[model samples]
Target: MKRFITGQHVSLWRLTKRVTAQNPMMKYLIKKIPPYPTPVEFWVSNVAHVTDETGFKGILKSEQFRAPKSELSWWDLKIKKEEIRAAEKNYMKRNFSNKAKEPNEQKPFLETFTTSPLFQLKKSRYGNYRFTFPLAELMEWYKEQNCGGKEPVLRVYGTVTYKQQIVYTVLIHSPEDSERFGEYPLLEASEWVRYQDGKIIWKAQAICETHRYQFVSGEVQRLKTHLFYVWDQVSLVFHLPNRTKPCKAVKIPRQRLIEALEACKLDRKIDLLRYKSPKNKEERFFEAKMKVSELKRELEEEVKEEKSEAENDIKMEVDP
Candidate 1:
């Protein structure tokens, strides 16, 4: 016999099925989506929170719905185990590849000294300067001098250059060594005694004159003077080193030219955006006008609200 089911009947069937799906026995029988493939992304992303294969296995084994080990075939267990191992390997590779690439053994300090620079003082074309000195050197020097125990660190004398201005700086290096290095040299002390107390408290031996080199600058300052003094003793003098040699002119390299071109292109793009065509300029002006108009409207609304609030207060007072 031919029997046709109405739409109402079909709806009722679906409703009944949905209601029965809530039943504990039906829950297991209802075909569930096969467990989603364990995402490779899960191993790498939010690494601090993700569980390892052992932890995951423990979770699966603890689940109430999981089948018993005995129920599963040996091949299934082997496959799952292999999958877990593969996942672990992927996790290890992702996390440890960089670590593996890192140098495990460091070369000796003396070996490194020949290869690496102890200090670097770089001056750029724009008059910016950068200086790098090893902190370990100062500590090592202090240790060698025995500044910590018995012996003190006296006045520290070091040459410091600021923007190509070389100054023979004498500072109280350490309280321990202060008395030793602070003592003025015999010649300077005699000169200081001859001069008035306030007239010359500190005598600085100037090897280079201020007004000597008016036109030359930077490393070229070396050309202005041929005489070099060490502790008031003439160490180098008399002979001119490069009297006939011409000064080298600064040339922009090809790479610098390419970089400049790129910079020019970017500046041109910005200029075009700001003032390319009358239409774009007009559009910008229109946007600015709209913003101003909006601000004016907001201010007017605020004023009206304030007036209304005052009126309301007055009305309330009158009613009272």
Candidate 2:
């Protein structure tokens, strides 16, 4: 009879345990526990590409600024207008000379114009666009403004042509340096193409309004003059037809470019590795708790199961 009672008790306990384990509440509790995070998943969650989310937009927005006109009494709008006229006059002269030249003579003039300080000609088989600026004259203007205590203003006045059609006038200026900063019109460009072969081949062109920016003081502030200096030297070398090797266009001096990058807070460590999510210490702690809580719940459930099994065995023996 005792052996029979032990067998019945064992069968009843097994049935009860199966029913309890299959209960909706038990299943819900089990699902409430999250799975352990793998090391690869954790690492991936922390780092991201520079182009992710607002990455590109954020960088661009940081570089943009529009100062009020009241703040720029120093920059006379008339000067910018005059610079445009000067560039226009030079363009007219070059157009006439270019039309009169034969194919052989044209190459010399084209090469000379590409390096001219008073003018810049970007030519390809597609078409040619000219950008003209008198750096010496602009420097004199800068001195007259007594911008020594202030940042230098850059004004780009040029034109673009495509398929033998005159596209539009290209004008851009540093926003803070303009009289009407928030309201002024300027050309907006994408990445500044690194100068190649003493020429710029335009990938595309558009009629848009935007501004160019520069730092108040640093290598970036003086970058314009430095690039122009290099351009002047390269242009002079190419002017000679008897030149042995082709003059490669260098955008900026190596040392100066390095110094400029170091001086820029954005360009220095921007491309380096950086954390992506959990942007703060508090969030990191929360993630740790999440992982720990999952492990803790699992351990507690395992202990509870072992205790239940042991107690069931003891009760079955005691009942018999």
Candidate 3:
């Protein structure tokens, strides 16, 4: 295999970096950070190639679940291409994204990045926003239609912002219907919700955004709604079951998608409830006022119960 960085293999690199310091007074077992970031995504057309790679199969594919490896050799060995174009494109897009531009200067910065069925909503003449599907609500609706009352997890997806907030267009699967979804992930409660150890914290919230996309789907897609074109797997920028937001549009790794799909096949008794933040100042004020009132009412009830118990105790002591 060709060395990614030099004639030096990744294992050699790891061996060299195993200990940062060797002095008796200042010895430290420092783990080496990966020299290269995981490829933002495989190239759009390279997804099938990725899936076909035996070493790149199953759960090992997703960047999130990657096992520790020699950073130098990951690209040359597991992923094949140095992923130069994908990296360069991501760099360019990130450097000059619309978010950096002034309001009037923000002209346009999107194209039909993914072959998702949500676009059909945008395709309709007068039912919704004219140019785009905006993916946020469409996914939630897809879960509703396909999984019935059971929770649906987005195994892989792309992302876009709807009205300034980020949204995801994704491949969804449910845990309850294992026959149909047994191959996918059934993310465990502990894995789904992570905590802040001394090192870092992880939090995820997925609020349901209700929409009429299902009604619209009945017309345009009929029964053959797209599951998204498999070729552009890297185009999945943000996964639906993910809380971490991406700044630029990129395809998700196909290997990552498969692991998530396989793992989310079971509910795992995880409460992946998505909470919605208040949209406006008025709603925030009302929510705050209600919370305060509820707290005060509970305090009063507790005080009254305590006083009643004291009085009963005094009566018993005096009578006895």
Candidate 4:
């Protein structure tokens, strides 16, 4: 009959069997099971933790009740070893094949230069070169040039690698030299090795413009002229006109009046009415009074005309 046991019962059975097997006389009393034991307390603890933390409850369903014992023969071990060896060999072969596709052989700096867009044969006049200098040597040269000051300057570094090994020292140059003569220059210190396959083909130097003084100057001047033009336009738009006196009371449309004010403000021609030295306050007052008097006389004449017209109309009506 197949027997079912609780997890705790399994642990107790395994522990009892282990104790029995340790004694030669009790060994026969304990039967060896094909599948080996489970630790019930461990499972119970894990389950309790998972439940309390609200984590990984699915693991309980998949938990193994017993561990399987390995029953490998000598021949099985030999076959397994052979399989591992084959896997390793295949992995190595694949790695070598990939390396072959992209050969690790480092080409000479000149050969690399020839492949660059800036240094093609057709662009010979455009300055093309290569450099081979270790960092130490490059730093020495930099110090010699007094360019080690604490200013931000462009720097170039390059390396030549073959088979994943750096076979040549890199060269370093100031940004100016790098720009004029391709990044790699022909002129480099003697300590570095030049390589064709691993040889230096050629090196040249050219000047690079670090600061464009003329271009910057022109840009600044252009901006200044633009600002001046804008200021002139604003001045013309917002200028207030000289007011001799608050404008006379007139029933003019608001829009028309605003437009007139804006026009007067923008008008640059000097306003003759705003003479620097008005003859005197008295003169100015007298002139203003005379103007008012003339206006009053005109108004009186207009009233008289209207009155005469009304009188004539009354007479005509009586006669009729």
Go through the candidates in order and give each one's C-alpha lDDT. Answer: 0.25, 0.25, 0.27, 0.23
Candidate rank order under TM-score: 3, 2, 4, 1
lDDT of 2 by residue, 1-320 (tens): 00111101111113224334534323322222111110000000010011222322232334211122222211111112233333323433444444433433332221212222212211111111111223333333333333433433332222221111112222222323367332322323312211222222122111011112222211112122222111101010011111224311112222222121110111221122243553443443345345334544665677799999999999999995
lDDT by residue (1-320, candidate 3, tens digit) is 11112111112223235322442211211322211111122222111111111222322334322222311111101112233333334533554454344434433222112122222211211111111122333334434544564555533222222221222222334444455544433322222211121111111111111111221211211223222111101122122222224311123343333322211111122212232343433343344345434545665677799999999999999995
TM-score of 3: 0.20
Candidate 4 per-residue C-alpha lDDT over 201-240 given as tens digits, one digit per residue, 9 for 90 to 100: 2121110101111112112111221110000000000011
Clashing pairs in 1: 152-176, 152-177, 153-177, 154-177, 154-178
TM-scores for all predictions = 0.15, 0.17, 0.20, 0.16
Q: How well does model 2 score by local distance difference test?
A: 0.25
lDDT score of residue 234 within candidate 2: 8
Q: Give the Å error, residue 16, model 4.
A: 98
For model 2, the superposed segments whose C-alpha errors exceed 4 Å read: 1-137, 146-149, 155-179, 183-320
Q: Which candidate has the highest lDDT of all?
A: 3
Task: Give the top-scoring candidate (TM-score).
Answer: 3
Per-residue CA lDDT of model 1 for 1-320, tens digit only, reads: 11222111111113225434434423322332221111221111000001222322332344211112222100000012233334434433554454322222311111111110111111111111111112232223333333442322222133322221222222213344345445523223232111122111222222121122211111112133332211110000001112223311112232222221100011211121322333443353445345434545665677799999999999999995
C-alpha positional error of residue 24 in candidate 4 after TM-score superposition, expressed in Å: 99
Q: Report the C-alpha displacement of residue 93, candidate 2, in angstroms.
A: 31
**lDDT winner, 1 or 3:** 3
